[model samples]
Target chain A: MIAVIDYGAGNLRSAVRALQHVGAHLQVTDRAADLEAADAIVLPGVGATRDTMNALQRLELASALPRLIHAGVPFLGICVGMQVLAEQSEEWGLHPCLGIIPGTVRRFPSHVGKIPQIGWNQVMSCAATPLLAGIPDGSAFYFVHSFYVDTLDPLLVAGRTDYGIQFPALLHSGNVAATQFHPEKSGRWGLHLLRNWIRSVT
Target chain B: MLTRRIIPCLDVKAGRVVKGVTFADHIDAGDPVALAALYDREGADELVFYDITASSDERAIMVEVVEQTAAQVFIPLTVGGGIRTVADMYRMLRAGADKVSINTAAVLHPLLINEGAQRFGSQCVVVSIDARRVPRSHPTDPLRWTVFTHTGGAGRATELDAVAWAKQAVELGAGELVINSIDADGTRDGYDLPLLQAIASAVGVPVIASGGAGTLDHILAAVTVGQADAALAASIFHFGTYTIAQAKHFLAEHDVPVRLV
Candidate 1:
């Protein structure tokens, strides 16, 4: 079963429902044991990265997540979930994250049109990954966040999207793959991407 | 590049979708869940469900409507109307709404916008403003509009400057603003371009133009002339006067970048 980590993030229901619709046998759990037993893991989140980190720490899933990813367990992170995979974030203040990916989460500059870039923005694929197999490059995906992942290693960057500056839209490395956009809320292409991820992992 | 959004707003009352002319003379459309699915398939960028129900007892039905619609619709869903507190926002978001839009409550409390944004990020809080143009005293004076609330009867005027309130709401943590014009709502003539332009230019966040959308040109004008990030309409989509695909196609033909399915 795919374990979807639920650590009091906003709009967990939408992620859960979308996963279910895509034919995934998943369990929404806050327990580490569930994550350990699951074949794959999906960490879905909304809101600030600090709040997500705090909740993950409170639930004792913070350390387990990095360990599981290192153990080669297939993993997917959405929005703040993807942000927390970075080493640290500049949102609010300098704070350590899971450190699975050598990167820092940075806020969009004021000239990027909007602070919390909320709408459908195009994601251009950088590499041919299974996560974006059938999905077309430059397809519009629903994005609702203020921060973007600035990875240290450019090879791990699977997709790039532009607002003011080009930012990592999808990150893929070893057993872990993450997306800044909410694939659950991106309609057809979003669902297709989820199905592609599930197929690759399963 | 980010594409301009085309959203279908469903004015739901007592679990059923309804439309009105200037917020009166309601006409039953269809089931919200079915219409939501249809719009999703028709390539609508997003969906907004405004619960127009008056009684608190029927509020539960709106949650159910959101729950059912979210199960089938994969796109972003925004729920507005009757959201008075953080708990009310929580209820809708918990039931699968991506964003909770608060209009009158945000105006009345003002702090509710901050509280909601603090609890669930600014991206989840959408402040909707219902504004009607105030007749100018002299021809030399610039165009002016005031905010209005409680669209149950004739609507109550708040006498707040719509443009100033747009900026203030963003400062108070509104990730987005939906500027709905009462003067042009349901008239099917066109959106109040001056009002939309004023508010859109006033705020940095994405502003969705609501209340007036008659033809495909009107929708296109929203982004091009009105400077809105999104155009929202009810009767046009509900009555099958135009499909979401047609709207996107028209916008794309007119050089406005849109997601075409």
Candidate 2:
């Protein structure tokens, strides 16, 4: 079964609907026991990194996730969920995050088109990973974010997409993978990616 | 690069799609779920489902339709037409809406925009302004467009200028603005280019041009001339005057960046 970690981050319902559409056995909760029992986990979030991190800390999922992910259980984080996995973010001043991944999230510069870069943009696969197995290289995904991750290690990057500067759109290390875009709302390609994630374990 | 969006607005009442979209493959012409699925298949960049239901039971049906539609259609869904409070916004968001467009409530209680934006990121909050051009009271100034809260039904005009309201709402945390022209709505002539341009240039965030879209050229002019990020139309799409594919193709041919499936 897949456990979608819901720590009060917005858009959990849409994530649930997408997973349900793909026929995945999923539960939306922040309980430690649920996270521990699940064979795979999906951490979904929207809104600011500060809010998401605070919710995770309040629910005690912030500390619990590292152990679960370190145990080699399959995991995926979307948007703010992925941003929080970094060491810190520059949104609304310096904020600490999970530090699971070695990176810092920064807002897009003023010169780079728009602030909340909202719309469809093409993502190109950077590395060979199971999460992006069947997905095309130049596939467009629905993106709505002002921040992008600047990773310390390049090997962790799985997919790269350009807005003003080339930022990591998808990242994977062993069993843990995440995307900056909301795959739940990205049409057929999004569903296919979720199916692939489910197919990896089941 | 982020391309311009082509959004199809579905004015839903009760559990049915309003104005009745007569698609050949659809079994029920008024089914919101079926219409949403059809739009998604036709490669629409995004969709807006405005809940125009008046009754309490119909509101429940609207919520159900949003949930069902969100499950089937895998694109960004913005729900509008009855969202008032942050709790109401949460209700729709939890039921599968990516964003909620607050119209009446936004005008009455401006703090609702800040509250909704603070709770569910700025991207999730869209302030839709229904503006109509009136005769200028001042002799020096030429522009005279006032914001309307409930135009056409129980119309209430406010002293707030449309351009000023657009900037103020953004300052209060509205990520995007949907500028709807009351005079040009359903006229099928063209969009209010001056109105759209005034607001679009005033705010840094994205602005969606709504109402008065008749032909493909009107849509093209919205992005090219009016400087809108997205063009939203109702009858032209619902009445089978034009498909989303044709609009995208027209946009692409005219050098407007669009997602063509």
Candidate 3:
């Protein structure tokens, strides 16, 4: 079964709906055992870095996340969940994150047509990964964020999305993977990509 | 780079989109679901639905319309008019509205914006303003624009500043703001560019210019002078006078960075 970690984040229903539509076993919760028991783990998150990280700490999923990623378990992160893979974030002051991948999150400067690019945008692939398997090269996925991650190792970037500037949309390294766009909300193409994620592990 | 957005708005009353002259004189545009699907196919970046109903029965009907639209359209949908409380916001969003807009409701209780923003995050909260120019209030009269509600029927006297309110709303956690000029609403005279420019100067978020929009030149004027991120129109789009494709083309010709439909 696939375990979808729910740490009091946004749109759990949509994530669960996407998983069910694609015939994926998705048990949504903050429990430690579910994270350990599932064939693959998907961390679905939204909102600012400080608040999300705080919520994870309050739920005690902060420590569990790194352990799961380190154990070679196939992991998929969504939007803000994808950002936390970086070393630290500058939103609402500096704060540390999961740091599974070597990177840091920074706010997109104001000149980029408002702060949050809230809508569907096209993403270009940068690296090969199973999580992005079968997805189109310039597929338009739904995005709603003002912050982006700057990864040190560019080779791990599986996909790149451009708003005012090009930013890493999806990152893949060994068993760890993440997407800056909400595949669950991207309709059929999003569902197909998410299904491939579940299949990669199980 | 970010592209300027062309938005089509549908006023759904009793589970069906019925366009009205000003606020009354309602007429059936079409089935809400079918119209939404058509807009999506026509390449609209976002869709806005204004529920002009006053009571709970009509509000329930609006929810049904939202459900149908959400099921049919994949693009982002924003709903306004009658969203008074957090529960109301949740109902629309749960039914599949990408965002919920509060206008008269926020004017009555400005804290409602703060409360909703805290509960649902600012990303989902949008403040829709309906401002009318009352000459008696004078050019220097900060309250010249009377914020209207109940479809421009009722409004309370206020010495409050609209610009300050917009700034505070953003500070209170509103991700986006929509400035609708009641004076220009349905006038087809063009958008109140000065009003838009003022709001854009006051806030650091995206502002959508609504109300006036008669010709293609109006849209360009709004984008260039008004500095609005998006332009929303009802009659023009609902009546099929100007398609979204045409609007994008006009914007592109004006050297504006509008995402082509």
Candidate 4:
């Protein structure tokens, strides 16, 4: 079973439906027991940094996540979920995050390009990670964000995407991994990613 | 580098794509899903689905069409017409619409943009403004334009300046703005450049200029002279007269930087 944590930020149903489409049985809940019992847990979000933290806290899943993740449970984060894996964020102001990865989430630098980067962008796989099994080096994924995670080690990035500055679109460390772009919305490329994630644990 | 976009606006009503001449003379084009797939393959940077039938019965059709289109095309999809609240925006996003564009409902209650942006990201909220030439009382200056509601509006007040409205809406958190000129709608004469330039200059967000695109040169003029990030057309695209691929090819040769097929 794949547990998709729904803190009510936004777009949780899409994640759930995408997992189901890939033939993965999933439950959308923020409970610790359900998360621990599942083969994998997906932290999905779509909003500002502060809002995402507030939603996780309101559901009391902020502290429970570390416990499940540390237990070697396969974990995948999507979009804002990828942001929370960092040390902190500058979305509205500096806010503490999950700290599963050593980095900070900051807004993209000012440029002539659109702020949101709202479209299908190519993601180049940089490392050999199980999370990217069958995915090519230049697979287009759906992305929509003004902020991205900046990490201390480039090796943690499995996939890098270019907007204004080339940044990591997918990151993985041990049993934890996250994708700034929504794999659930990235068509065949996204489905391949989810299947790889499922194959990792099950 | 951010490339200028060429968009095909599909007014899907009851699951069918209906394009009009001047927001009238509606004709059935094709299924929304098929048109989206074609646009995706033909190099349309993005696709916009305006729910012309905002009626309750037609809303279901729009949602179904969106789900179908989402499965087929991976390009950005902007949905408009009938989006009134945050919940409505959420529903569309879940259905796989990339952006939710609100027109009359947004201008009527500008805070809707903020609320939608708060729940979702600003990137997901698109505020579309329908403007028309205010018909200068004096012949000296014919550049005055005012905002209107509904399709091309009907005796509504043209008091609001499009630039002012776009500025305020962006401040309230509209990620992108789509401006349509009533006088230029389906005319094929050309986009209202002065109006587009004013609105684009006033707002920092990417502004999409819509209306009066008959030729590929019209798109070039809108992107360069009008200073818009994108040019949107319906009739030329729906009628098979000007394919999106050809338009992008022409714009690329002319150095407009549109995303190519």
Candidate 5:
């Protein structure tokens, strides 16, 4: 079963429904035991990364998460979930993140048209990965966040999107993959990407 | 580049779609869930379900509609109309709505915008403004518009300027602004370009042009001339006058960036 970590942030129901629709047997839990037992893990989040980190720490899943990811457990992170994989974030002042990936989460500069960057933006594939197998390059995905992950390793970036600066849209390493866009909300292309990730992991 | 979005608005009253949807394959046109799925399949960038129900008792019905629709539809779903408090916004967002739009509630309690943003982040808070053009006293004066509330037959005009309100809403943590022109709504002539341009230029957040979308050209003009981030229409897509695909195609042909299915 795929364990979807629920830290009581934004809408996890949408992510759960989308995963179930794409034919994944998943369980939404705050317990770390579910993460340990699951074949794969999906961490979906919204809202601020600070709040997300707080919730995870409160639930005692923060320490378990990095350990699981490092243990070669297939993992997927969305939005704030993806941001928390970084070393620290600049939103609402500087705060440390999971440090699983060597990166910092920073807000989109004022010149990027909008601060939150809400709406459909194209994600251009930078490297070939199973996460974006059938989805076309330059396909638009639904993005609703103020901050983005700035990875230290350029080789891990699977996709890049440009607002004012080129940012990592998708990150891939050994057993972890993350997307700044909400694939659950990106319609057909979004669903296609989720299906691809599930297939590759399963 | 972020492509201009095309949104299809569904007016839901008592859990059912208000307008007649004439999709050939759809069995129940009044079913909001079925209509949402159909629109999603047609490549609509986003779906907005405006709960037109008045009483609080009927509000639960809209929540069920959102829950059912969110299960089947993969695109971003925004719920609006009758959202009063942060709790009301929470109910919809918890029911799987990606965002909750507030109009009169935001005007009455301006802090509601800030409160919702504080809890759910700015991205989940959409402040919808209904504005009508106010007559200019002097020829030398620029075009002016006033914000209106309770956007139906019982509309009430407020002293607030539409452009100023747009800026204030953003400052109060509104991630997006949906500027709907009351004078141009249902006229099918075109969007209030002047009003849209005024607010779009005033605010730093993404502005969605709503109210008047008659033809495919109007949608194209909204993103290009009106300087809107998205264009929302109800009748055009509901009555089968145009499909979302056709609108995107028209915009793409005119050198406008749009997502085509």
Candidate 6:
């Protein structure tokens, strides 16, 4: 069973609906035991990195997540969930994150189109990964974010997209993976990605 | 690159879609969920549901419709029309709405924008402004339009200028702005391009040009000439005048960037 880690930072209703539609047996929970017992884990979040980090800490999952990822637990992070995996974020002035990935999140420059790139944009696969299996190279995904992860390690990049500047849209290392866009909100291509990830672990 | 978004706005009264869609595949033309699913199949980037009903009983039905629609439809769904306070936004979000748009409420208490953004994150708060062009008596007035509170009904014009108000709304943490042209609402001549351009240029966030889309050319004009990030329409798509696929194909052919399924 897949465990969708929820800490009151974002909407898990759509995520649950999307995953169930893909025939994945998953439970949305904030418990540490559930995360440890699950076959695979999906961390879903939205809103500010500060709030998300705080919630994860309050639930006592902040320190536990890095150890789980290091132990090779199949994991997927969405939007702000992916941002919290980074070392730190500049949103509301330098908040520390979980450091599962060696990177810092930075706001997209104001000169680059709009502050929040809130629309469909094409993402191209940068590295081969099971999480992105069967997904096209340049498929459009729904994105609503002002900040993006700037990975220090280049090999972690799995998918990249362009708004004004090219930013990492997807990342993968070992069994851990993440996407900057909301695959739950993206149409069939998104569902396909979720199915691919579930297929990998199941 | 981020492409232009084409949104089909569904006006829902009670639990039914106000303008019946003509899609033969849908079970009921007035069913909002069925229409929304058909639009999703037609490759619509996002869907907006405007609850036109005002009564408390009807509002509950609207929430139920939102829950059912969000369960089936995966794309971003924005609910507008009756959202008044942070509590109203909370109800919509809990009901599975991705975003809540406020028009009169945002104008009445500007703090509602800040409060909603603070609670739900800035990505979910969209301040919709209904504005009409001012009949000019003085040539030197920089303001071309005044903000209208009650969907631009006569005697509803406020002291706020459309462009200035848009900039201020963004500053107060509105992630996006919907500029509705009152003069061109149902007439469908075209979008108020000058009004759209003025506000789109002033704001750093995405601006959706609402009201007055008669044809595919008008949609093209809204994005290209008016410089809007998205074009929203109601009657054209609902009456089967044009499909979202056809509009997107036209945009792609004209060199405007759009997501083609």
Best by lDDT: 5
lDDT tens digits by residue: candidate 2, A45-125: 777898888888889988889888888888899998899889999989998998989999999988887688988888888
> Order of candidates by lDDT, top first?
5, 6, 1, 2, 4, 3
How high is each candidate's TM-score? 0.96, 0.95, 0.85, 0.85, 0.97, 0.97
lDDT of 1 by residue, A32-133 (tens): 999999999999988888988999999999999989999999999999999999999999999999999998999998887767788888999898798888
Where is the poorest 10-residue window by lDDT in model 3 chain B? B20-29
In the range B1-261, model 2's lDDT, one tens digit per residue, is 677888999888778787985678745768888888888989888899988877878888888988888878989999998777898898888888889999889999999999998888899999999999987778677776899997637889999999999999999999999999998999999999999999988998999999999999999999999999999988999999999999999998998888767
What lDDT score is found at residue A154 in candidate 2? 94
Task: Choose 1 or 2, whichever is better by lDDT.
Answer: 1
User: What local distance difference test score does each model get?
Assistant: 0.90, 0.88, 0.79, 0.81, 0.91, 0.90
- What C-alpha lDDT, on a 0 to 100 scale, does residue B142 get in candidate 1? 94
lDDT of 6 by residue, B1-261 (tens): 788999999989989998785676645879999999988989899999999898999999999999999888999999998888899999999999999999999989999999999898888999999999998878777559899998623448799988889998999999999999998998889999999999988988999999999999999999999999999999999999999999999999999999888
For candidate 4, lDDT tens digit of each residue in A72-115?
88899999999998889988879999888889999989872667
lDDT of 1 by residue, B1-261 (tens): 889999999888999887632211232346788778778888999999988898887899999999999999999999998999999999998898989999988889999999998888788899999999888889989999999988756789996999999999999999999999999998999999999899888888999999879899999888999999999988888777888999999999999989876
Q: What is the lDDT of candidate 2?
A: 0.88
Give me the candidate number with maximum DockQ.
Answer: 1
TM-score of 6: 0.97
Model 5: lDDT of residue B93: 93
| Residues B74-156, model 5: lDDT tens digits | 99999999898988999999898999999999999999999999998888899999998888789879999999998855899
Backbone collisions counted per model: 0, 1, 0, 0, 0, 0
- Candidate 1 chain B weakest ten by summed lDDT: B20-29
Candidate 5 displacement at residue B39 in angstroms: 0.8
Q: Tell me the deviation in Å of residue B116 in model 6.
A: 0.2
Chain B only: TM-score of model 2: 0.96
**Off by more than 4 A, model 1:** B20-29
Candidate with more favorable, higher DockQ: 2 or 5: 5
Q: List DockQ for all candidates.
A: 0.85, 0.77, 0.31, 0.27, 0.85, 0.82
